[model samples]
Target: MTAVAAGTALLLTGCGLGGAPATAPVDTGGKVEGTITFQTMQLSPTFDDYLNATIDAFEAKYPGTTVKWTDIPSNAAARKVSADAIAGTLPDVMDLDTGTLAPLGRKGLTVDMATAAGDVKDSYVATAWQSFAFGGTGAAALPWYLNTPVLISNKAVLGKAGLGSSPDPTGYDELLTRSAQIAKATGVAGFQPTETGFANSLLTVGVPLVDETATKAVVNTPEAVAFVTKLAELYRSGGIPKDSVSAKERSEIETFSEGKTAYLESGGSRLKIIKENSPAVFGSVAVGKPLGDAAKRTWVVAHGLAVPTKSGNLPTAVAFAKFLTSAENQLALAKVSSVFPSTTASLNDPFFAVGDGDLTAAARRIAATGLRDGRTTVKPPAADAEYGATLWSAVQPAILGDVAPAQALGDAEAKLTKILQERQK
Candidate 1:
């Protein structure tokens, strides 16, 4: 069966092999007073004061309700959440991204926020709200904060390469050419895509990682192959870092901070770190739109709140999730961080709509503009992550000259097909 079909069957039979209760419809109305544990990904300690204050406000708004919030480190979050889900101890409300929600959604572990969200649906950005709808399922999460990609440049290095003040790349080809020029002229890598995971790179350029329905691989298309080839060429030409094949987004940020790269692909939120770690580079920093082909569209990374279907306090949990994602609360979080709020009402606040004379404000405005226009990349089923990891691992050999791009993609496709077959069983 297709993954979606399998998921449907699984849900119909009760969400688990042990006969856990079937998924429940969201309950948005009625009295809501109970303790709900909220699991977040790395929002603690640093944002503790802000979060605590918000929780306090929530408690004050809904008397007799207690919110116990905990944050799991991002690196180990997936495994931790898996363990929790298996133990039937998932938090009542969860802060989740698209990738993490895929398996949960498939298992029918989350509430259908579309029904639960009520009038609040119109409060959130359309794209953000739409992102959490998995496999044609109704939205299972309430959109919260967003991070959108932008092309950040070191003006000094660009000037040294003879690229004009704005050095905005028109497309991937232009990006590669400019990167080669910058490397040759200034001895600095020309560019780095914000998310260095190869699959993510393809997604940024509007290449779908798998066929629609998530049943098979589609990465061997002419456009995708050309993208992979250009990336391999860039790596070979010294325009991309040697270690970048396995690099994460933070690595690119570090390279840019250290002044080792001319163009750093990252979100506007990085401006704070750049200003703190490399004040001089920060002075030379210029933000531009993300580069892509005609299919070029900006990417928005969003984190939202979800309630597990098995939660005993379904009404309370759904209520708390909505409370946390409400426009007032969302804007409160946005005021204290570089991340943009997901709600249209929050985005319309003077805080996001107007830019001050400062660089941070300008950066925020640029990111906000991008978020308003960008599309959120759809993550496939849980198995798609495995497929992506395999693809990333397999492509490095091709990029490093160990194999041809076509051969590498073909092998990856075959492995993905095998995975799909196994899922059918």
Candidate 2:
């Protein structure tokens, strides 16, 4: 537990384990009053501002109780959550991206929400609701905000490469090849993102088809491995540069704005960041759906609220979680955060109505914003939770030429097997 800011009951923390729960009831004992801490994601200042505004509103709505928060950097939130739990206390609630929630749920750290949300549950989308189930066990989190990777390219670079229009959104392989030529000729970086298993992941984003339910390791399957291998080839051929590793997703937009890179894996949210940095380039940059290759899939990641088993204040905690996600707060969040909103309505709201400018055009053209299907599914692939570390670790070395893809994955396969066995115990 963290220190409550003098007098105000606010200190951030995290906790839990999981299991299947049939249903539960909402507590209506007036209002439970106590200090509750929330974990925030290290998105941008926009998310921070939105959190502050929501906390203020929740406090005003519920007297005698208060909310406090601690912002966790994206890279560190997972580690912090795990470490905090081992210490025997957790923030009453927290924000987490998709990849981190599963392992925690396996350890029984999160409260299942199916029963917790009750009658009002119908309000959320089916796909979003399904994300709460962990390894087919308990409900772990809620859908809050989502961002999709879009195909962002430089008009001048593309035009020079004979690609028509600004975004064109016509070809992925062609773009990769053309970008390589451009980089070789102009020395401008072709892509700001280095491929890990990401190129393969991008393929799925372009055409999403992963069957985690099979209890098989598909990442090493021909389709996925080949898709990823092609990306590795591109990286080796100077089609994608090493500097891409240093490019923060946020900075990738900046690199494009400054005309340093020709192609990028960015999204609708980057529009605000790009516009802020250079309005001229922002208008010129192309925004469209990721060009389909052999398949069609789109990728999205969301961060939202969750409560800990260890929190002493469940009533206040749930209230704050509910209040924070209510339409009012969600819209408030969309305005400040500038990322894609999670609510069906917030996403449909005219971007100008929510703030200023048009998001609908882009949303429709690219279908760039959508809830993650993997999150709320009633069932998930058995080893899905333990796959990340192995999958990525296996893929990374091969992508960097430290090991052959097959060999690296072999090592990872062993570790993956170990992790699963350990978790069972």
Candidate 3:
């Protein structure tokens, strides 16, 4: 799994959908003063100081407002939120992502941030803000932190393949060609796709997953079929590892760190993990722009602050949500982590522009450039997991050369179209 997939998995596991319709939005007319519960996903011991300090500052700003902070393990957060929603005891303010916020927004459990706080809309990147908007629910949360994938390569592996230590591929085709040569020469896999699956892979190559109305799947086109065929050929030729066809993100990292793979596409935040787990491999890694349309259509993952519609103190909750995502607070967090701030002004900080000629710094600089065009690429109105599962199940056979590429994609399109139709009803 790449860092992006690992982070996404953490968020997705915590997003549980409920069947009940929620209460209407709270009136936003009162003073921003009250005791409000705040919940966070998996930011505990390591960030205890920063979070407490921020909470203290918020309380100071709004005298009389007492903020109660609770941090939950990422795997347990979704269930806690769902249980609270059922009991009508949801936190006034919660940290959430697009996946966790979607079903709640659909059921009217969250405040319409875009409507209640429309004046602050321009404070965030347009795509980041839009990510929280679901069908007819308006924007459900305030955009917070974000990350985009960057290309990381092993110079030693590339050199062994006779490509220069710093060879750069202009696009995916060239990258694949180089990967094949590296595998043949060095007896190592050249690349490994994240276990999160290939939906993003198709999207990165210009394959439209849905039609204009989002009412049909249109990925059974010639371009998609050709891509799948190429992937199968690559798999058969040993350019991609056999176990990687079903391995998790951790496996992908291990493979790369062990020098079994030459390239990896992951969030820059992962550089620290590599440095800690495999110092030798980390020393040889180089950061560069993502290949192909990925450079132009970078996949972004964003987390946000949400206020439940049932909060006892809606005004205070919303106020804190805005304060937490403000340019100043966001930059403070970004300065200490690999995440980029959603606020436009935060990106202008010199820290993002400066590189110290090291792997981590280079990755941060490259990722910030990609963030200007970054967006959440595969957002279906409903049944997002089902959509990915359908694609993976249908495409896996073709990738293993057990089914024809065209037939596999045709089946996937048919199944995805049915899913879209069912969602419409």
Candidate 4:
């Protein structure tokens, strides 16, 4: 199988569905009817099709409701959402990142979703629910889906490293050392940290880049100092090649499949990609619980629902948002999309009770044990923001040893500080 056969594209974890949010309450369980326009991207092939199927099922149940969806390439969704907002012609329902929500909400372009999201609010996991920052209690913008990032490992690689199945690594120190050994012995990329793996971009590496509490960015701090130092050491040690800086989704996925890398970072949809594209690689791949230590927050990405303040079908949109994210629906979607659901009960489903593959087991690990209690939380750095671009510019050099760690960090910090502070002013 190949990427074409697997229908591979971008698999967005932390699709930014959950983030800063607002809440409102309204009552409507009867005959919900209206045409809602939605937008999706090139990232996930199933997004539009799955939504349309859901819309059909919903219309059948509700009788009079209708939904119209539009496909905007993933790269275009942001701009499309913005253009709609300006034209005063917005979809009744659409997906936007959490950061985007802050601006839209502040601009009064988004209404609180808690209004018609009662059942939805009740079903999703707490932290997942919290992502929306739904209106406190009994009030929230309905939640849509979730993205749980985990380490997808080639179990076979572990054997070569003289290690058994992956152990719970203690920290970045152990993690890097293991990868280094794997590379040196096998002549392969020991630990693969793809550009796609931004799970650590903000919270893990960015903690030092930004302020201590996360309200500010000091990316050039000692923490960044530590991060880049390890990165430079690994790069110079010949851990990974420099060509991967511009590689996209399938490249990293394919490399792991070819045994060129021992470990790679990915989310729920990765399992699907392997299953459909590279069956051989899929068989060799195994999953590990999220990597990191107590010092870092577990990376969590949830997709929630919101009403564009400009939505014409606000009431009906609220109803579907609630219905789609309900406990039953959450479970149902897991089967269709091959990703984890945002609700706790979904994990107990027999479908997830048994580990089928790296994809299945890893997603279940995150859903059942990782953040199920809401004790661990992770947020993506403002990746689509200037902070992201600054880090991107520095990641390659820092990881590949093109520049010194201190110099790379200094340049990144200066650029990022200037970038983030610009928005404040």
* TM-score list, all predictions: 0.85, 0.71, 0.88, 0.78
lDDT string for model 2 (23-95, tens) is 2333423466878888776745645565676788778777787887877666566566666766757788877
After superposition, candidate 3 runs with Cα above 4 Å error: 1-26, 165-167, 208-219, 246-250, 292-295, 373-390, 414-425
RMSD of each: 5.1, 7.0, 3.8, 6.3
Clashing pairs in 1: none
Give the residue spans of candidate 4 off by over 4 A: 1-53, 60-64, 99-102, 114-122, 133-140, 165-170, 198-202, 205-215, 245-250, 272-283, 293-296, 356-368, 400-407, 423-425
lDDT of 1: 0.70
Estimate the TM-score for candidate 4: 0.78
lDDT of 4 by residue, 150-210 (tens): 6677777678767656584545567778877877877666665554453254355435345
Ten residues in a row with the worst lDDT in model 3? Answer: 1-10
Which lDDT value does model 2 have at 422? 42
Off by over 4 Å in 2: 1-35, 42-49, 69-76, 125-127, 170-217, 232-238, 242-261, 269-284, 291-296, 352-425
lDDT of 3 by residue, 1-425 (tens): 10111223223224433334545656776798989999888877767887899999999999999999998877666566666776788899988766656667766779998788889999888767876876556688998888677788888888888886545775567777878888889888888865253666676677767775555898898878988888788888889887777444346677888888898887887788878879999888888887643436556667889888878998999999999999999989888777888887887778788877877878887777666545335333332455776787788888889999999999999988876654444
User: How many backbone clashes are present in model 2?
Assistant: 23
Q: Is candidate 3 or candidate 4 better by TM-score?
A: 3
Candidate 1 residues lying further than 4 Å off, grouped into runs, are 1-29, 193-195, 243-250, 292-296, 354-357, 374-388, 417-425
Instruction: Sort by lDDT, best first.
Output: 3, 1, 4, 2
Candidate 4: count the clashes: 14
